[model samples]
Target: MTQQGVSWIDKLIWSWAPESFKEAGESIVKNFWLHWFPAKVSRRSLAFNYSFWLGTISAVLFAILGVTGVLLMFLYVPSVERAYPTMKDLDYVVAYGWLLRGVHRMAAHLMVAFVFFHMVRVFYTAAYKKSPTGGSRPLNWIVGVLLLVVTLALSYSGYLLPWDQLAYWAMVIGSNVAKSVPILGKKIQFLLIGGTEIGQATLIRFYVLHCVFLPLIALTLIVYHMWRIRKDGGLACMDQMVLKSEKERVESVGSKTYSLLGITRGMEVNVLTSARAEEENLIPSAPNLAKRILWVTLFTMFVTMVLAILVRMPLEAPANSAVAPNPAKAPWYFLWLQELIADTTIRLGRFTINGGFVGGVLIPGVLALWLALWPFLDKSSPQAAGVWFPRERLRQNVVFTLIVLGILVLLFIGGICRGPNWDFYWPWQPWPELPMHF
Candidate 1:
């Protein structure tokens, strides 16, 4: 009787197990991972369930940056006057605070990298096709672009805090370059620097932008972007929907248009949507999404901690309005252009050009243009994207390649031809000499 009762208890436990741990009398029956299952989230996400873990990585990184930024905010003073010394103090006296700073920096870099990685993955999978549950690819592209911008802003703003040799010179270059804008250029540059040079005003403004504004915007966008992803998919596969018949296609159109907030031609036309609806469930659910989200978030925190402790980066001198640091260098990221414009020997025959246009102006300009154009350029029936090389590939490749080539050529010319002309020498060098048009 005792043995029979024990068997029944074992059977009961095995039946009750939540897809993880189970007891079969004397032996436990389950995979090694059964013990490590996660508590379910209210809303299941690829973050929680899936293995292709890009989005989860982004969320975890953002959390790290947010936590570290908040802590740093308490310690940071947004004053050119107090900023540099304050950073130095953090290094010397802030009780393991530098770890937070290091993690913040490293995470910012990683977030930028991950954004790029995410984009590549989306493209390769043709995941941008619109679906009922997951279709808003355009929104994803926009948010991704903004994420890159915020990453840049974070890097730019953070540099000013350190106030080091590299930092100071880089600011001078950035400010001067900004002044090269044709019309309101000087004014805009002045507004950013908060006066003529990198002073108390400039530092304070940067600190505010870096700590307050950019993060808020980036955070809001990421959340909104994710909500869009959920509304659109398992992962935006379109091929499953496209192969349906003409009758099915016509019916799907009016319904899809209304759902997308897209315009319709005639109210009289309504055919078939049910057949097309089956296309919604193409990509598999994010494998073990809950665990993925948890581990990714946890692991990023670990990485951030390691970066802070190991990196312990430095700060520069006190910002001085009076001193003009000669040979002012641009940030390493922007150095390619600074280096280009610095080349005075390559003159553009007659009109001495500024190379900053290529590094600072044209390349970034083209990148912006491409981001703006991607949705229209890539539009197609979701099902068609399954092909190895879609029929539309030729047109898109041609346009994309040409635009890319034009940008590179401009950068090359600007770098090679810019000389000691007033434009290159001191880009925003006070333009007092003016001709009131005759």
Candidate 2:
């Protein structure tokens, strides 16, 4: 494959074929990859440096999870009676099933981490702030945040699938937290569990949610998120130039304009070498995209495989509604909230707020709302948009960094430090024995 718009595959298949086939291949290649991603990207914005390609890494992980998850579905039947045994079969009976499940589980975890890293990268780079001429980036930022939420939901829903003590108690704690919401909490719980308690119905409900509904929604949102990245302009960094004037914008777009009536054939569309383009710095996406995606995919696969081999997915005793774990915990991602709820209460003089409502509902809701509205609220300089940790953006950066640190601290506490009765314990402390189910 070369920038002249011919691939080795095209030649292999179409060398003795019709010119129409060749032309078709060229057109598709031109319109698909090269059209959106021009020959030139900011040298700084290249995957070699600016991004570490976190977004691409996250996407690759999602794909890996999707493939492995589908394979797992064939073996797993979501029911109280069948779930745990099926998990054992996946590990011991099915060929390479443990590997598949392991990869899926690890990829899901990697995606969660990568998504957060991507958000941090976007923020420190000021990628979510407004562009010149006030074309805001907040819309895409909001979409990305929602994508993150979808990701968490996906992982949490899947957590219950093994139907073990870990899954069972986690669901109990998570659902009870949902039930603590001021109103509509019970309805939300019902929608999630399909009943008042964890049962065959709950497993089936979570099964569909994890395997079908959430994934579909996640894929749709992810596609939209990527589209918006292209629409808003690729990775914000030093390499991008803001189109300041309407004339510059039009000229920068070149002669290729889309119309409902259709683009006229035989019209000469100029290459994207408008007056604003820095031709010396531009490189074609043909080799770059291919190389980056391949490298990222391989790296992700290697890491996932290594993890899968070393740390098999855990399975505890099957769920029993009659017995509860000593200190039930939510999924690791939500441990921060769990810690907050366990540690504090809120009151406004005459008004008292339930700790669960404060930590699980109100605070998380406000934080999400704040994140969605941030682009509109901050009247920061557009010059700060592409730069990493610009001096002028110190205030916002510090604030976000503190928030992140606080969350990590909460996660550490909730995940490792708390033990029986949710009491504080050292990381090395032994857990109190609890009755096993099934």
Candidate 3:
């Protein structure tokens, strides 16, 4: 009954459970949760703060998505003919199916949101910088960036699985954008959709991608990211560690004696031990990480469930290749690119550029490359590490803030302000009547 409080099933599974099984369970928890945690962390590193808990919340959201997604797989049929009806059945027929569907949908959304915020938090605190006072590494920054990409890819791939009119056109616009790339555009689009156009093959491809490949990559990267966080001194304590190092260095020398090397004639050699001091600025990982994971998991799941109840998962008309919605749009996350296309065009001499390539491939590609190289590119002092929006880092922060604001502005325009034919219109305006695709 301890395994399942509902009773009969629990009794069947656990009442006759061996004592050895119980001992093994307890031992596993002790080894993995208790022993592993304390070995990785120190007392001072566990600060009770919002920023410190973003990663945990993101991880919890991922776990929720994984569980709900697996449950959904049991009910969903990926073929175009059955997909929409199956989705409807999930909502109308299956018991608590809507709850599972809603949770999975909302969890993916929240996970992406949290992961973006997590990156913002890391950037502001300069956590990607290596410590000059010693205990830091920047390699995880690249891992974090790759994880962000995988998270977004997972969302985008999953978006197509519903195979509604909305999902179909969104993928069409997205795939068209992929076709805008220079020489490899069509090849990439074909690879993605499994054909030149979206069809049955595309549906299965997306299902496999969303269900398998992207999740596996994301999980692997996330595990490495967490391990690196611990290896790099357990979350941005560089500020305090730097000060401690200075204090210890001063104490080791006894007094501020002038170096004889500077005076010239002869140099005084002070013998110091070769062993390095093991400084403990970390909080106990067992309590800190475990408690954080527990609370954040509960809170995130609760909010997601509430959202699932209040807002029904959107299901539009069944996909018809003969019809296209007025002003077909990409998913919200990629709406900024759509807006960019609406606003800009590139020209070099007599040749004009594909707006899709410009906005979707070129701009995003440049941004991604810059981000991947930022830790190596940044020339900021190590003292700037672990400091959020410090005066010394004002320039860097302002640049990043402007970039974020620009993307948000574009998202707003594409998502809320575009009308039929992509004309400018206010969000409050009633949507124009749907027109049949020619």
Q: Give each prediction's root-mean-square deviation over alpha carbons.
A: 12.1, 7.6, 7.9
Q: Tell how far residue 17 is off in model 3, in angstroms.
A: 28
Per-residue lDDT tens digits for candidate 2, residues 250-344, read 75357556532455443223323333354454444544554566788899899889998999788888877778777878888899999888765
Highest TM-score scorer: 3
Worst ten-residue run, lDDT, model 2? 266-275
TM-score of 3: 0.84
398-429 per-residue lDDT for model 1 (tens digits):
56557545645544444443333324423334
Off by over 4 Å in 3: 1-30, 40-44, 48-52, 132-136, 251-283, 346-351, 431-434
- Candidates in order have lDDT scores of 0.59, 0.77, 0.77
Residue 142 Cα positional deviation in candidate 1, in Å, after optimal superposition: 2.1
**Whole-model lDDT, model 1:** 0.59
Better of 1 and 3 by TM-score: 3
- Model 2 clash number: 0
TM-score of each: 0.66, 0.83, 0.84
